[model samples]
Target: MPASTEQAVRVAVLADSDTRWKWGALTARRLVAAEPTGFVLRGRATPTARQLAETGVSTTPPREVTGAEFLREVRDAALRGEGYDVVVLALVGGTVRAVLQGLSELALERRPVIVTGYVGVVYEKLADGLLLRHGADVVLANSRHDAERFRAVYEGVGADASAVVEAALPFLGGAPYTPEAGRDTLVFAAQPSVPATRAERVYLLRRLIGHARQHPGREVLLKLRSKPGEHTTHLEELPYQRLVRDLAAPPNFRLVYGHMGEVLDRTDLLVTVSSTAALEALHRRVPTAVLTDLGVREVLGNHHFVGSGLLTSFERLDAGVRPEPDAEWLDRQGVAAGGDAYASAFDAARERVADLLAGPALPPVSPYYTADTAPGYLPGILARHRLDVDAPEARPGGLRRLVREAARGAYRHGVQRVAPAIRRLGEL
Candidate 1:
């Protein structure tokens, strides 16, 4: 049977929740509901998929295909006698590279309108996905800065860039709770994987304990992602545990495991080293601080928070330093600007997809092309995939080599710098 335009859109979700799959599920639901033609979600054992299914959304088990096999499936599905007008690939990390490579190969035969939802900084991995040079018709960003970052990284490589306010899991509607008066408690939410850097961990611990001491009357809660495993006790190994124990008795300081939302709701001020929780706190209008000396200041700064002077140095805290709130910036970040922004973004995405389907076929580029044409060819390549990098690439070098080096650099830097910050912050 011939597939008709009126048939429900078959949207295959490539999801792994530890990454951006959770966000992908949320976006899928909204997209399916908005259009009369529903969508199908695919994932390998995702809680979000189950939730969607419970809500009566259609879902398919993620085929247990290796990265290469997955792309082959996408190619065949798009080109098979059956007409599948659009294929949305929701990917993060290395998976995106594989999908793009496959798309490029398939582009040699027939052009399929492919839309991709990337959860992290694509520029950081641009080299891995040479096919991205084909251009993504629409690129989504977790934040405006991320969108700008994408543009800065991919310009000239191919594809125009635009921002799609990342669709978030529907865990909380609007602000989850109103700020309570007389709430003087501070919560440090930590993820698992205790920090391995002795110096950094010690510094973070001292700052946290010092903050507790400064607000003597307030309760200090340490929330852990999971209960300490066999090798460690959440509190004992902590660098500042001894100091915290010496300064304040057990009752003043509490160690909590699990039930993050419950803890977040009651938190008066959220202190994070580099946890995304800071962003969540911001969305909730909860006063939050990111310990700067830990090397995550750039990320926090991009969010437009005024410098808090709250470094890892306890001496600074003892001096009664506090972060100054940028009222206007906070207001801009907190404003929900009605549903108009989201609606407009969705409309734009749909239009891009429709245009791709209706447009002239795109030409294929040789995989063996030299580095010189890499950036110039990228815009067209990415266009086929429906992603947009809003800014131009930063490096003056050839796009291919630049992307490759950038990806390697991001991997190394993220592990050496960002990962430690995340670990330390999560431990808090």
Candidate 2:
């Protein structure tokens, strides 16, 4: 509904992952879709400030930048005055800290960054989460429960209460109804973080093998987020190949990765260690069970699916356990039975974004540690942002990181050199 003559509002959504990108895209498009008010909005479509701001009336796509580039590759971009009225942080880990610092360095009215990635199984306790929650101008919460959690934490820490905006967690709400004609594939949407260690991973695989054996004809695929040596949450990089070799390479078991929709279409039963992927399976009405054998709160966020059937013991799998989807818990997570709420959330978010665009610019909010506490985090992120003086790992793309990278490279080179020798020794 933008006016034919008025300028469009440009928002740069910085994301490197699937979920962040979706939310960023949705939010950006929604903001652009807003009807024009009397105010003349401009600079919304410009990629970088060095380039001229466009006055055209069109929905500008959110500039999707990788987290690494936003954080480590900031100076050149910021120096060029290549910034946005809003920079959405859809990243986690050191990248979040680094990007915030880079934005602060630009000193261009401290552009408002809408902090995102607030959802179930709160990573809010982590360093990156803490920094993002405190640092962002607007913190988005997927559910009222999550919003309350954010509010409680902010209140306890005496931070800005106005930043939190509870909204429906963005989802692929319009998945085509997949009919189960003859599909019987059982999929484990595996996580590198779950199963904790190498030994635990082996145990889980062994359990899967045992369960697969029970259903003689069923094919089981372990879906991994990334291949070996890829970036993930786990410490060790154990490949399914290694596990298969160790387990004599079972025929029915294999590692697979592709579109979730494709997998769900062919899947008879979907299982996981409390992955958000569970929501997808449940949406398809695919028989789903949240693996809770570990029951560790930090690792297994399975509690969020309390009403959904828990697959704690493989013995239950052997005994023929079926998924009992919890309509209430699912509704609360904005996954099931609450389709209306989810839709409404999108409308509200658009309204909110429009309001955010119109509101007078406020002082820059702290994007690190504790916002309420001044002189936050010894050798605080502010120094790194303004001075570009890094505080070790706390700062992104710095001297220590370069040194660590060199060391890691040398170590990896040594491993590659030694690997062939080790294989020969095993043969001998």
Candidate 3:
């Protein structure tokens, strides 16, 4: 592309320091390198920021911006006669939903083209087919199986039901190893919330403890990712901690917290209750077993990649089998599919953004000026600020209520100490 055309095609990504952001940053770098004039707008707090900055990529200051702020920034840039060729909202779940709702209200005129990558599971109400149906110009799935699943569910919900499965960031390579006898080491990656899954994780950990005792020299490592200070109490609160504590007393069992990449690399076999880490392990050609407890087989099942050395089990893993992933297995796991598919998905998103920009400008949908247009937006913001004021619940049902209360407590306890600025913003 010519310099003028390249300069006109700026791309901005809204993401943080997560796996998805790492992939998005890689893709952005590739795109900008292809078109030298292309610029990347990235959040300072994003995990990939330092990596990008090392490569001489310009970055914006870390802001406590939400999905609403993301959209507003894009719009503001356009209003100031500065428009991007594409604005990619690489957020998952509630954030994505908020962005869509905000866009719906804006009635944007000459809006910069918008695109989004659906990187998380669509099983939850906040991150399900509803958001997929209304949020993006094009919905991109991490796997073909996921794409088909999304279409089936969305079709039932009267959604457009069109989506492309693209290999998620950190593209996989062909599997190189065959199953070989190795030391007995098991690794488990923890997920964010959803107590049911956490319970399952506890159960799996207990089972692994038993296995370690039986196998003598075998080892079990539980990888934990909890906020500081909260980690000790949270672990102490688990019903299985007694088992874990006993196991920790022995030389065979260990608890490893933090340093995810290093832990994964050292593990012999990986086990997960329900986490995207299983996919990450797959990339490393590690044999992975996913526990199917909590009656969540349909949602957390690993049956789709059975032939790929990725096993789903409700029971303990058998000791004799040496699991190894092959090239054919990687292909089945969507590793054979090239990165171009992901790029194509981005292209489709670009088309949708063009359509939006070709139309008229829109007005703001959210009246409260908080992050989301949803009912609990104000309260959620206030709770984060530790304002000591009661706000309406963000989600429906008792479970959401409990989660909000917990979040509020987290905010009040220590989040306020880390950043008193949110309180100032809330006051304003």
Candidate 4:
């Protein structure tokens, strides 16, 4: 809690996507007794109205703003001497770096306790992501395995690792799994950019449809991350929705979207290539499998599950092979099987936060990559987000807002329309 007696602790969660928003908001609540105000970073993967509504996490609606606009808001708040007690940066590495730089520029008298972390399993850009997130008061690691890895990455580079705190995925909560009598629902959680290709996506979809064909009595769902023209954390260049249009699918199988936890409620079996949904399902003791039909490759991210005992092929699933999750692996990964452990996952984080809040004002946010350290690198990151040492101009409005929207619309058009057409032509 904050030093203020009149108001509760104020926490601001800034996120780039719907999934990140869920993680950020939930993590904010878990870390302290606070109701987080949400800010959606306007970008390609900006959460849609439907996606935001589906999360059902934040009580207040999120304010959508570009990177510059967000920085202005923070700077203004700091100038007013009314900054949030905590600000959770639920964004990508580059954006995190940019925000850190922007904050350092503010040099406020009372800076918020900055917190940042990964949304899920970090199969890619381990060093890049961890280092970019370095200057926060808390760099949360979602598992013991991640905590160790994060420390190693920082210590390897001689950077301070004190900020890396172990915590579980904040979104991991639901009713424990129980056997459903008839029409068991099998959901194949889909990622936007994993196995990033039309053929690979189609093959996975066909495999899912094949399973549905084999188990006619069972209900199968392709739990999509985003609908058409809507992006998630990753860009869906070749969506399953576009490919499924040509495929002849069975009535038992269909595409579904919305909250993953709700879907897992009736899920008899949950399958994925390497989605974080696997962790969510495992937390609830839901039958989960990391698909091996695509091969246990790092590119597909299933390599992260090698020792989890959850990796199996669609063939095995078709043959009724339900994997018993490795208990040790689950503990190491911080996916609690309910009870006291799961409840206490954020205890360390909470304590760390309390200590920070009670202590003297925090030093300026000093990211690892600075102009002094990485003159060639740091500028590019900040420039990408239009951030600088000086206070930003007023928030985007009138002509500026329209111009930004037009540019964003053009970029989205290139992604959702022009680029896919080019890919299809190239294939031909």
What TM-score does each of the candidates earn?
Answer: 0.58, 0.73, 0.62, 0.93
Candidate 2 clashes between residue pairs 3 or more apart in a chain or in different chains: 9-44, 10-44, 135-366, 135-367
Predicted candidate 3 versus true structure: per-residue lDDT over 1-428, tens digit per residue:
11243245566766543444444544454433332122222232233223333323334423333344455565666577665555455554445455555555555555444455544444444235344334455455565556666566656655555433243443333343244466667776655343334456556666766777777767777676543223220122332333344334457776665545556666777777556566666666667766554544544544444555555453546454544555565654454344455344344334444445444552233222334444455345334322111223322244745675567556545532344355345545
What's the lDDT for all of these models?
Answer: 0.46, 0.56, 0.48, 0.86
- Per-residue lDDT tens digits of candidate 2, residues 244-334? 5567535777788655567777787788877767777776577787776676365466656665554555667668777576666666666
RMSD of each: 11.4, 8.5, 9.9, 3.0
| Regions more than 4 Å wrong, model 2 | 1-5, 16-83, 93-98, 123-128, 174-179, 233-236, 307-312, 367-428
Off by over 4 Å in 4: 1-7, 388-402, 406-428
lDDT of model 3 at residue 2? 18
**Per-residue lDDT tens digits of candidate 4, residues 212-246?**
99999999999998877778888778888779877
Query: Which residue pairs in candidate 4 have backbone atoms (N, alpha carbon, C) closer than 3 angstroms, thus clashing?
Result: none
Best by lDDT: 4
Better of 1 and 3 by TM-score: 3
For lDDT, candidate 1 versus 4, the one ahead is: 4
RMSD in angstroms, candidate 3?
A: 9.9
The per-prediction tally of clashing pairs is 37, 4, 10, 0
Taking all chains together, the TM-score of candidate 2 against the true structure is: 0.73
At residue 283, candidate 4 shows an lDDT of 88
The parts of candidate 3 lying over 4 Å away from their true place are 1-4, 15-62, 120-135, 152-184, 194-201, 228-249, 257-261, 292-296, 299-309, 312-318, 322-333, 336-428
